[model samples]
Every structure is written in C-alpha cells, then in structure tokens.
Target: MNRKIVVPPILFIAFVGLIIFFIPMKEAFTFTEHRTENPKVYYLPLESERGFQIRYVHSIHLSDVFETYEVTANQKIQLLSMQYEDLAIGLPGSAEEGETFSFQDGLYTLTYEDNVIDSFVLLIGDVDADLAFRYLNKEINLKQQLERGKSYAFSVTKLSYYQMLRGGNLNDNRTKAA
Candidate 1:
C-alpha cells in the first residue's frame, strides 16, 4: 500500500540526514578567533598523540623560538619542549621543578614533565613577531591567516561542517612565506 511505501522512504531520508549531520562532528584541533562580532573558526583533523610546533620570532630578542606540543588522548595540550636563543627578559633563566634545561647548538631547550593544559591563547604579534604552526611537513603561517594584534584560542574539539567549510585550512593552500 501507499502507507508502507511512504514510511520506508521517510525513514531512509531521516537516516541519511543524521549521517550528514554527524560526519563533520568529528573532533579536531580547532582555532577560534576572539574579540570580533563574527569569529572565524579554523580546524584540522587531529589524532591523539600527534605533535605540533609553534615557531615565532621573539619581539625583543628577534630570535627564533620554537615550542613543541602534543595532543593527548584526553584532548589536552601537553608542552613537550621549548627552544629559544635568549636568556633575557621573559625567558626562563632556570628550569622549574619537573623541567630540564640544556644548551645545544646555539639554542636553549627546556623540556617539561606533565605540563598540560586544556587550551591556550595565542596572541599574534602586532609589531614584529611572525608566528607559524607546523605539523609534520605542513606549515601554516598563522600570522597571515589571523589578524595581527588579535588573540586566538587553540583546543581540541568538534566543529560543525558549516563552520569548517567557512574556515581556512592552510594545509590545503600554499601561501607559505619564503
């Protein structure tokens, strides 16, 4: 009968719709812009235990500083190490408890133990710092994608497909600075 035929089609359509809605809800490393009427959200597919690095030039020292982090299975960010060239202002002169500091090849490295956080805010340099995000061989010049002088929050979370579509995935584009 018509009733049976219609019911099956309706159920099929509902199932497809649910799949569409949930597919892009997968968790990712999401970067959300702050202090704007309309905040932009950028996301990248991230697997637990994968590592990334943020490299930037110190405004005062003008030297390269690299900070490495890992995504924990519990969706936390763990500070793995920090490499910098300055012992000047704003730089840690000595390691705190549970951290090891050493100098090698013109750079100072501070490796941490259990330094984890739920999220962190990244402030783009308004004056002289150039910040970049590196994962594997792929690099995203965050200074180019985000507004200078603004802050963006980084965390691991889920985002809708619409939001992901509107945001930039620097991995797909090649606007890398030379």
Candidate 2:
C-alpha cells in the first residue's frame, strides 16, 4: 500500500549499515598498540634485613612513558629523584623526544635529580612504562624457557588487580628473580 515510502526507509537503513560496516573501527574498539624497539625498566626500592635494594618489577614500553610512577609500598619511602638512561651498548638513537632508542645489551642509568632518592634504569622501548609493566608482568604458563640472546614477541593483556593477583599468580611473585 505504501511502497514508495517503505522503499526509501529500507534503502536509508541499508546505506547507514553499509557505512558503519565499511568504516575503520579498529582504533575505536581496540587497545592502542604500543610497540617499542627499546623498552624502559621500572624498579621498586625494597628494604630487606641486609640493606636497601632496588627490585625490578616492570618495564614501561616507550609507547607509554609517564612523568610519574605509582608505587605501592607499606611504609613511606622517599623518592629523591628519577631519570632515564640508555643501556643498550651498540643500539642507535639517543633519548630524544619522539625517538626510540635501540638499547645495546648492557646496564643503563636513570639518574634522579636528588642523589638521596633511589633510582632505577628503564630500557627504552616503543611502548610506555605502564603498558610495558602490564605486558612483562603477565603470568603466562611458559611453554618453553626463553633463552639468553633470544627475543620473543608478546601480546599485551589488561588485567585488573584482583584478576592479576588471582589469575596471574602475583601473590607469590617477586619483582625480580632473587
């Protein structure tokens, strides 16, 4: 009975659906991929009976380097200063804005403004620190041992604290291999 009006509405709905389907929605519904040729390392200052020591926990991928670090500590530990250093010995690219540093295999330094504050070294990478921490801290059941001199690619998965603590087995995990 109303063929003309019905046809127009159907065509409009189909056109809109086609537009939505063909549009690039990756950026809108996906997590930002933070790639890093060189990654940054993060550490926590741990006090033991022996003395004050730095425990390496997370590495911030260059993609998400933050100005401030969130640390969970039982006692109030003073942060004197923080700085970043390049550890890769033969890697190219210096620590410049928007530049990724290729770290040679070596120890780099992160100098804080105050010497009294404990400092840690972050190996520069394409991802930011927080994302790096999340990736590196994941508890994947190792199918095989990662050998020295070998590199592996991993996907970053976001996990809540409760999930991480339970599924990640983070309750008994240490920042570094003691």
Candidate lDDT (C-alpha), each: 0.80, 0.29
lDDT digits (tens) for residues 16-126 of candidate 2: 886765553311000111243543221221222211222332343232121223222322223322223432333223444433334233433232232222223232233
Query: Candidate 1: minimum summed lDDT over ten consecutive residues — where?
Result: 169-178
lDDT of 2 at 128: 22
- Per-candidate Cα RMSD to the true structure, in Å, reads 3.4, 16.1
Candidate 1 per-residue C-alpha lDDT over 44-66 given as tens digits, one digit per residue, 9 for 90 to 100: 77754389999888878899889
Q: Which pairs of residues collide in candidate 1?
A: none
* Cα TM-score of candidate 1: 0.84
Positional deviation of 105 in candidate 2, in angstroms?
A: 18
Measured with C-alpha atoms, the lDDT of residue 58 in candidate 1 is: 80
Going through the candidates in the order shown, the clash numbers are: 0, 27
List TM-score per model, in order. Answer: 0.84, 0.24
